[model samples]
Target: MTMRYDPHIPDRELVQLADAELPAVRSSEARVHLENCVTCRARQDELERARERFFSARSEEFAAQVPAVDSSAALLRARMAGLASEREVPGFWSGRHRAALAGLAAILVLAAGVAWWMDGYRRYPLKPDANLTPGATLSVSREQLCSAPEADGLRVIPAALAGEVFHSYGIRGPKPRNYEVDYLITPALGGATDVRNLWPQPYSRGAWNARVKDALEDRLRTLVCRGAIDLYTAQREISTDWIAAYRKYFHTGTPLPEHARFFKDRPWE
Candidate 1:
């Protein structure tokens, strides 16, 4: 008869290799191997017994080491009193020190207030009465007159004629006339007329003159146009013919003949 080899020998050896934590081997060959492995089966049993003994020893040692907790009111009170005593002694800062601190705080607040006031003064400075005058006349330079764009089509009147016209229009005082001219060149005339039509309306003549005055003041203040030749140097060249035409027809120097006088005091002039 053929003999069947025991496969249990290898399975027993594997259980020993895993320290007795072995999975079941189902094959006949593996069972036969395990059955023949007597040394491996003995090692597996010894490992399992050693593990059980180790766990039982550890459980006893842990039970012995655990401490019992005490709950006495006297101990708790003593601990709280020790903490309170440690905090009771005054350190660097005491009640007298608090007064000094308050004084220092007050000084800081005063300093901040003074600084704020100084900053405000710097931002909004005081001015003299002279600076507040309603109308102040300023000399117009040639460069200013010429700087107006040619496209603006400004009529170039002689300075003398300009003065006369301003006088006729009730812009008598130096201040008012100055203000009037300023108004004319800036927002007034520029806003009202296009390049093609530059004349002021009869009613708005004072306003137009003011605008011109403002323009002249602005140029003078900037120091841009300075001379007589500079006065006529317009970006838009005013033709000599046009100047002559204005001088002849719209002369402010000559009083209009009786039939042409439009208003009672020539208020619009």
Candidate 2:
């Protein structure tokens, strides 16, 4: 039997890898780890793609300001360059002048519904028992459970906490082999190792199980780090609904082979 590689590369390291900022030894180790780990490799790919997308979007905006090669183009270029250099911190959903709110609105709209399967990037079907972390309500900030690895929350929520999580979710009599107690945001992504991020995910159920979500978590972390998406957005997407997130990152409605559909026919039972 093949061993499942669950230990993940830290979120900060993944970002550093994407930015090519790692030192020689660390980079060499990370490369070796990525070569042996399919999930990490996929995450690295997404990070690279996200970085490319971010810069490409910025380039497109700059390209649009080229003044159409007119007679007064020199002055226009100077003005455009001046305009480009001014930086402004963007607020959530404000979309800024460079990005519109259409995508944000779409995520909100799609997040309200649950019928999307094998479709575009959308939230996943949330388990009836899924929940946020304990620290989620302490006014501590959402970044504790939302932003990937910025907090070095690499240690998973201990297994001893599973019973408490299951109890809180009202899942009784679920065998250890039948379900997995997992983090909603996931530790690899800076999700708190507390009750709020914990849930009883069924290994005995459908394609949308812990294994599938594990992949999504890493992918989302990579995207978040690369600025492809915001941390708040990724948190909202996963905590409320992960199926949509899975599709968004994996770009497939169908479950990957790692996720077993053992009881696909009776997911809720």
Candidate 3:
């Protein structure tokens, strides 16, 4: 039999469903509910649309950024020629020295593979987990968010709330030096100061790290205040995918030069 339909599914569960992270049985039940209930189906459709927008925008952006095949082939030829010369070196592969060198090569290859995997896996949280951080915001009007004097700097997240964010993200031990607890929707744009809006964004693990996102937040705030874009639109763009928003606003596939130079890989204090 299908599940009861008295109460609506919680948003957290729906988010998990949207992300395809829910357990099989629970996912099946949610799908059944969605098929039967218009309200839940509509909410599910909205979440799917957001995901579609991110995927569609990201695919288009990366397609335009791909390097030319001829350039890649030329680089490969140069590397292969260098390898050939190294292999022809006299006595380079002799006896015990060869064995030692082989072992070292194996270790180096393993190390490189692990580093590549990690860089691909955790270079940065490309997107915050929707179930954990769906973005939160203050109930402020555009005038309040804009007309008010900007703070001298970012406000310090409360120790308690910071701890909560770490716990929610399943992070253990001391906070990593390369990550910053940042808002999904920045406070400058009226984001709330809650754990739900906060995440441990990598500081400099990749080109699209916290520093790059900071530039986007600043630009969006400026555009909103100047009436160039609606406040809600600014919030949605950043909240959905700041990198996509960055590309859209800056009209560049990569972070601007000034933004790239703005912050170094400094350890978080």
On TM-score, the leading prediction is 3
Relative to the true structure, candidate 2 reaches a TM of 0.42
Every candidate's lDDT: 0.35, 0.57, 0.74
Per-residue lDDT tens digits of candidate 1, residues 157-217?
3455445544544334333212212122221112222222222222233222222222333
Once superposed on the true structure, which residue ranges of model 3 sit more than 4 Å away at CA? 1-124, 175-177, 263-268
User: Could you tell me how far off, in angstroms, the CA of residue 163 lies in candidate 1 after the best superposition?
Assistant: 99
Instruction: Quote the RMSD, in angstroms, for model 3.
Output: 17.2
Which 10-residue window of candidate 2 scores lowest in summed lDDT? 116-125
Cα RMSD of all models vs. native, in order, equals 43.6, 20.7, 17.2
Rate residue 40 of model 1 by lDDT.
55
lDDT of 2 by residue, 123-174 (tens): 2223533333432322333354444234322344455687677666655665
Q: Kindly list the per-residue Cα lDDT of model 3 for residues 159-213, writing each as its tens digit.
A: 7887787777666664456677888998888999888898878765668878888
**Top candidate, metric lDDT:** 3
Superposed model 2: Cα runs more than 4 Å off: 1-156, 258-269
